[model samples]
Target: MGQVSDRRRIVISGCSSGGKSTLLDELTRRGFRTVEEPGRNIVREALATGSDALPWVNPEAFVRKAIEYASESLEAVRELNEPVFFDRSSIDALAHFERLSIRTPSDLKMLGEACLYASPVFFAPPWHALYEQDDERPLPFNEAVREYDWLRLAYPKRGYAIIDLPRVSVAARADFMLRTLGLPLSKAP
Candidate 1:
């Protein structure tokens, strides 16, 4: 399978409930393709099916599923010619393994190295005002902050530069990301 170039695959990641989803929604509204976060989908499915593949219930299973979902997401969009935004990627799954003190499988590590995202990965910094607990995201504010810390380190360790998205209106964030990518800004509908 061909790998998507780092420049065309953008990852929007960071703290939980830190507005990554909202920013992605804005980009989608402007007609960009986006991939949903794997954890949220996993949580939703686990809840509906009463499965143990939940982060709190079975973290190992959770991370495994996340890796699978993220990999599939990457593959699904590999052929797209336009910029494709991902809420989080397999690197986030690797970080979760780190958080749990588990050794990453060699294949997972290789996959992380192979699937490159755009440099200067955009991170939504911890936004206390915007943070809210939901069924899919049950982490407390402090834990969310810690996850952000881990991601801040993880992406750089994987050779990606980090760019923290400014705390501003979602539209403004979208415009900033587009401008930073040198893509044309979409006029408001």
Candidate 2:
């Protein structure tokens, strides 16, 4: 295991609509620096530009662009003095490749292995009632479930501890995550 710094690279990851974004917003509101998910940004940009760099259209191109974004996201925090939260990590690209049954590029495989997040990665399991589709996330409930399973296996394979987030109110989830990381819980304003 790599040495963990006090400035943890915490990744909030899981299937779509599982409240990862909600918790990230809460953490950011509480003053922790955060990096948003690049997949949606990439998707929106690709669609806007009429590019074929979508997961379904061109999985390799999609992963390549995602990996690039993820790298930049990581680099953005390289000099940070406080713990930073990431909505997703580079390993997610590999998981997507797995979920899509797409061939994982050797370079992407290496990137996933090289870039690491702190252990006890927060995982938002599929919540059926809360699940909804959007333009960026069109994955159905069943596919989300499968993606969750793949994540459960993928993160651990990369030597991360999968911390399954409870299905609770977003505020409560934020508290739970802070508690899990031994950080003080935030008081309401």
| Candidate with the greatest lDDT versus the true structure | 1
- For model 2, residues 1-189, the per-residue Cα lDDT tens digits are 976657689998988788888889999888778899888888899899999988778888888888888888888888875678899888888888987788888987777667767888999989988888887778789988888888888889878888889999988999999988888675345
Candidate 2 to truth, TM: 0.91
Runs with alpha carbons beyond 4 Å of true place in candidate 2:
1-5, 187-189
Pairs clashing in candidate 2?
none
lDDT of 1 by residue, 58-117 (tens): 887888888888878888887777788999988898898898798878877776556667
lDDT of 1: 0.87
TM-scores of the candidates in the order shown? 0.91, 0.91
- What is the overall TM-score of model 1 with all chains considered together? 0.91
Clashing pairs in 1: none
Which segments of candidate 1 are over 4 A away from where they belong? 1-7, 187-189
